[model samples]
Target: MGFRENEINGINDLNLCDGEQAVNKTELIDHIATSADISKAAAARALDAMIDGVTTTLAKNDSVTLVGFGTFMVSERAARTGRNPRTKEEITIDAAKVPKFKAGKALKDAVN
Candidate 1:
């Protein structure tokens, strides 16, 4: 099913057809505000702070673990040779650090 911007009132209003449903930042903030009995602005600030914390930790090549949620860390990728899809030319892919997340057992269990 297709989703409309106006159709979303909160998380529960999502239509999960073939897992196509998604919760956008605004919707999440709304949910947080209602659940925490806070204002939307406060909820947004809290969400932004949490994201900033995770990003800052990952930038230091460290991991942030929320016991019942998940762990976010940075993983290094080795430089490798790859072929360009359009030109079929060989190119070297540079090594880099990328952020990764591993769901905790509690989160996994909640999903299941």
Candidate 2:
């Protein structure tokens, strides 16, 4: 049942710096597996589920809030006029619903 045992072992072998190094998807999956005591495949599925749920909720004009983590929501932007830098042509920027996130108090506190 150690389908990802080799990958996990490889991740553990790498020396990761706190803030100096960028952690990629593999590292993230490895972390999830170790922290949740689940298989890498399960962790990947869980992450995918979370992403899909957030995207679906936002598409419905709703938000997803992980109490101690953050909130994912769609914010509206008003139509505005803008100028193109290269051609210096004026343009109308259409209003749209953009995704946003605000970290929760716990997450903020944890970082600081």
Candidate 3:
């Protein structure tokens, strides 16, 4: 199934990197289904599984590396003092562990 420009709903008019149109999760699911010759439901499940696995690993302070694709890791962000722009009031920003991604060489080269 394909969606014409007018068929999609609730999508933002946002241009992404290199001026390419932004693709949402639904579109990505469709692409995975088509490329892998799998049912849409299966593709969604696979995608969800990958996401859950990565999240679980990160939560454990570990990283996931898909050789040429990329690596998913977490980084510690130290707590800091921040200021409110409008009120000029000081605020406390708590430390947190943020997830990060680093693209591998092959993925970078494929894009370029």
CA shift of 10, model 3, Å:
34
The models' CA-based lDDT, in order, is 0.80, 0.80, 0.80
Clashing pairs in 3: none
Off by over 4 Å in 1: 1-20
Deviation in angstroms for 41 in model 2?
Answer: 0.6
Tell me the TM-score of model 3: 0.79
User: 1-112 in candidate 1: lDDT tens per residue?
Assistant: 2333333345334333455567678877876776678999999999999999999989888899999889999999999999999999999999999999999997797567
TM per prediction: 0.82, 0.80, 0.79
Sorted by TM-score (best first), the order is 1, 2, 3
- Candidate 2 local lDDT, residue 7: 38
16-104 per-residue lDDT for model 3 (tens digits): 44545666788778777866789999999999999999999999999999999899999999999999999999999999999999999
Per-residue lDDT of candidate 2, residues 4-66 (tens digit): 222343343233564545567777777788867899999999999988999999999999999
- What's every prediction's RMSD, in angstroms? 5.3, 6.5, 7.5
Instruction: Provide the global lDDT of candidate 2 against the true structure.
Output: 0.80
- Candidate 1: C-alpha RMSD to true structure equals 5.3
lDDT, candidate 3, equals: 0.80
